[model samples]
Target: MNDQPLSGLTVIDFSTLLPGPLATLMLAEAGATVIKIERPGGEDMRFFPPKSGDVGTLYAMLNRGKRCLELDLKAADARARILELTDAADIVVEQFRPGVMARLGLGADELCARNPRLIHCSITGFGQSGPRAMEAGHDLNYMALTGLLALSRGSFDAPVLPPAQFADIGGGSFPAVINILLALLQRDRTGKGSRLDIAMCDAMFTFALFAQAQLTTLGHAPKNGADLLTGASPRYRLYPAADGHLIAVGALEDKFWQALCDAVELPDLHRDDRRDSEACAAAMAERIASRTAAEWVPVLAGADCCATPLATLEDAFRDPHFLERGLFDFTADADDTPIPATIVPIDRAFRGRAGAIDPD
Candidate 1:
């Protein structure tokens, strides 16, 4: 039996950066034949810094297991080639502005009309028909517009920039992949296909579920840093050790909280954090700062508390747990050298071979 779910499917990807490329990458990993179409000089991401030989590491990581084709889409011959490819494709993913593809005669309407069974997905910041559809924006702008950034402000002076592109991957790529799969399933049932407009901003509102609940109950959401999960409670915040390393505390339940309090030897007066949350947090912070992360590791290890020392990227890459799980088993080739492939959330049973690289 075939392990790859999308074994015989074909995907034509016109996405330049993270969202579209990532969606197609997931499809490719699931055994789809993904053909990435780039402009003459290739996409802007190809020129991004930190290159591996001639290709950018970011671009190589995302575009692994996909075929490449360069074409000037504005030219007549290019449009003809795309239409021909659309005739045989199962899915087409694009991340252009609202009317850009339409102006180039490569819009979903034109392509779907030709194939009638193509699952066309368009990923954009705002959407296809909204007033802001034509406006230029990135991941940060999408988060800011969706009120997600306001929930976890860093300080009064400036808001914190997220370490990852939540809106781009969570909102855009994930939704696009999910809907494309759904569309494919639906097409199997009814001999027809559909167009999906995946607005990155529209999906980010779901990430604000906690804030929305507070807003519904109290007519307004809690201010930044005041929410229970956002540093208000000592049980669910990051505490710094004497060595300046941070420990992520997630002892939300009573049992875990009690375990954490006992392990840290927190005072009885500050144990009942409900009485004075700020004072309790301050006391806990003081205790955590008294010892270095290394000294506290063994004490917290057997406590059964959810607290853990924050691991840097380098540390995480070398973590024994992840290595035992074979998270980096697969490798993508860059300059003919094998680099660890970006691991997606697909089950190993449904993914491609562990050591397989994309064929040229």
Candidate 2:
């Protein structure tokens, strides 16, 4: 039996940066042949900081296991070449503005008309037919527009950008992958393909489900930084240790909260009232600051509270749980150098234990 689910699939990727690339990367890891089509000087991400040799580290990491071909889409011959490639391709993933692909004569309508079975996925900030569809934006802009950024704001006036690109990966990439796979499954049954319009901003609204419920059901709009999951509850928050390291505390349930209070010897902080959240948070913060993260992590673990010390990127790559699962065990490049990578979140039985790397 074949371990790779998408072993026979071919993906024509015309995306740069994170969202689209990440979706295709997951497809590539699932055994799809991803052919990345680049422009004249390559994608903008290739010039980003932190270079590995001449290539950007981020680009190198995301584009691994994919074949690259340069094409000047503005040129007639180049556009002809894309149509030729589309004739034999199973999927086409693009991240251009609303009308850009149509102007270039490579839109879903044109391609899908040629190859009736082609799955075309377009990832954009707003959507295909919205007022802001053609507007220039990025991950932060999407989050802000979709009301996700308000939930992540600090106590101060200035909004804090999330540590990761929430919209790009969460809204854009994951949705594209899910819908593409669904489209493929549907194609199998009907022998016809469909177009996927993945709007990052539109997708982000789903992440605000709880907040939306509060507004519609209870007629209460959640305040910035004061929602249940947004630091309004003491049980679910991050505490700073004496060593300046942050320890995440997720003792949300009654039992876990009690366990954390007992373990930290702050039984008074186990409050069930929203009115007491601020005081409880302050008390917990003070208590947590009395000990180092290394000292508190084990004690919290002993109590069975869902508490843990925050791991840096370096520490996370070396974490035992991931290591035991063989998530970082990737295939080496042509130079025989191991390219570190993360595993797609899937059933362990279906995953390839080794990493996928591009040739040197």
Top of the candidates by TM-score? 1
> Candidate 2, residues 1-360: lDDT per residue as tens digits?
255898889999999999999999888878788889998888898888866566666776777778888888998698889998898999999999988999888899999999999999999998898789889999989988888788767767665778988899998999999999999999999999899999999878898988888889889768887777887788888899999999998888889988888888885634544667777788888889999999997898899989999999899888999889777775424234455664566565555443434431
lDDT of 2 at 133: 82
Clashes of 1: 0
What lDDT does candidate 1 reach at residue 254?
A: 98
RMSD of 2: 2.4
Total backbone collisions for each predicted model: 0, 2
Cα lDDT tens digits for candidate 1, 9-123: 9999999889999999999888888988998978888878788887787887888888888888988688889988989999999999988888999888899999999999999
Candidate 2 Cα misplacement greater than 4 A, ranges: 1-3, 268-275, 331-337, 346-348, 351-360
lDDT score for residue 108 of model 2: 92
> What lDDT does model 2 reach?
0.84
Candidate 1: segments with Cα more than 4 A from true spot = 353-360
How many angstroms is residue 73 displaced in model 1 relative to the true structure, after the best TM-score fit?
A: 0.3
